[model samples]
Target: MFIESFLILLALNFLSAGGVNRPEERIVGGGPIEIEQAPWQVSFQIRGHHICGGSIYNADTIITAAHCFFLSGAWQDPRHYEIRAGSKSIKSNGILVKVAAVKVHEYYVHKENQFFVLQNDIAVVRLSERLQFTNKVQPIPLAESNPEPGTMSFATGWGNMYGADAGDANKIPIHLQGVKLRIQSPNFCVRFHGQSKICAGDSKHTICTHDSGGPLVINRQLVGVTSGRGPNCDRPATFSSVPYHREWILNAVKSFPQHV
Candidate 1:
């Protein structure tokens, strides 16, 4: 009986932490959105499974959180990843393209103790082939300036619909989802995530686990990349500020010019 109980507990832990159907890929308090509405969104998958969210930077490039490529304290190979674009569903629909290269920010860091810590959590992904642009497959422009606190922003992803404490953390949605979040002041964001992150969200709406590497847009401009969140889904979420790293992003894209 004791052994059986122990086995059950172990299985539950694994399901909660690593199960693909688990709540890790959620946009809490969000609703289904059409692919044409957020055409720049993409799914950063590993071995055909949606692991993180990203945004289409151009026909052959994607921008996502660097931590998406980090697993078990190590960086995964770029070859193991692919980008699914022009779709609203993770299970079906979209153009799957091979990943040619992944470039993480030079200052990015990943540390683990009781909890994981990520810094400078941004990355750029080069695609193996150029994407054919359509109304449902377009690029979003990077924000030239950060939005002031109280500005409204939008976040999209295919993560969990409920918080971890809600006893339904495994409720993974089938279609893409989005929510409106209010940008918090730099002082408020820095207090929790430091200066390198942009803070946004509220008690009613926020990003969740699989939402990492997703885009946070204001006025249709990419202002942030989803990075982290508080203990609950209702709390504010943090992102890598696009404006703060705009130069690096531009240079990175330039260094990897598209082939004719």
Candidate 2:
């Protein structure tokens, strides 16, 4: 009986491991959007699979979450990544650009516990080649200041659409998706996530796994980078504030090899 119990436990562990490696899907409560509507959205992919969302910073720079490239206590190689831009769907209609370099914030940290903690969750990605600008592909302007509480914002990504209680067999959406979110009070956000983050969303429209590094925009200006959510994905999502780290982003872009 003990042997049988051990075998069952081992089987369960294997299944849990497999689940962790599965590619997550779209934003919870969001609807499909056209690429032209969010021309700066890009799919951050490893090999040929979509993993996270990013925004175009320029013809050659992409901004995303630092955690996207750091996992299991190690940073991922830049050569293994590519960006899919100018397309609404990850499966088709986009230009895939190779990665030249990735610059994660020096202070970024990942802590695991009952609730995961991510700090300074921002990164700059340099593309191997300059992207040709079109109506369906353009750079977004970074926010210069924080938006007041109750300001309406939008977040876009190809992340999981359901909460943790939902079954994993749900079909993954192929197109880009977006949700409307409201900025929360700065005091409330800083209480839990410190001052470098912004809090937004409601129980009904929170972001989920795979949305990391996606853009949170107010009036077409990039305001936040999707950071994380609560354990059940039912709380307001947290994002790395762009205005808080704008200087770092500018410096990272400038430091990249100009010829690349």
Off by over 4 Å in 1: 1-25, 165-170, 189-195
Q: What TM-score, over all chains together, does every model reach?
A: 0.86, 0.87
**lDDT score at residue 101, model 2, on the 0-100 scale:** 96
**Cα-lDDT of candidate 2:** 0.77
lDDT of each: 0.77, 0.77
RMSD of 1: 5.9
* Alpha-carbon runs more than 4 Å astray in model 2: 1-26, 164-171, 187-191
Tell me the tens digit of each residue's lDDT in model 1 across 57-127.
Answer: 88999999887776644566788778889999987787999899989999997764444466788999999
Candidate 2, run of 10 with poorest lDDT: 15-24
- For residues 70-89, could you state the per-residue lDDT of candidate 2 as single tens digits? 65445667776789999998
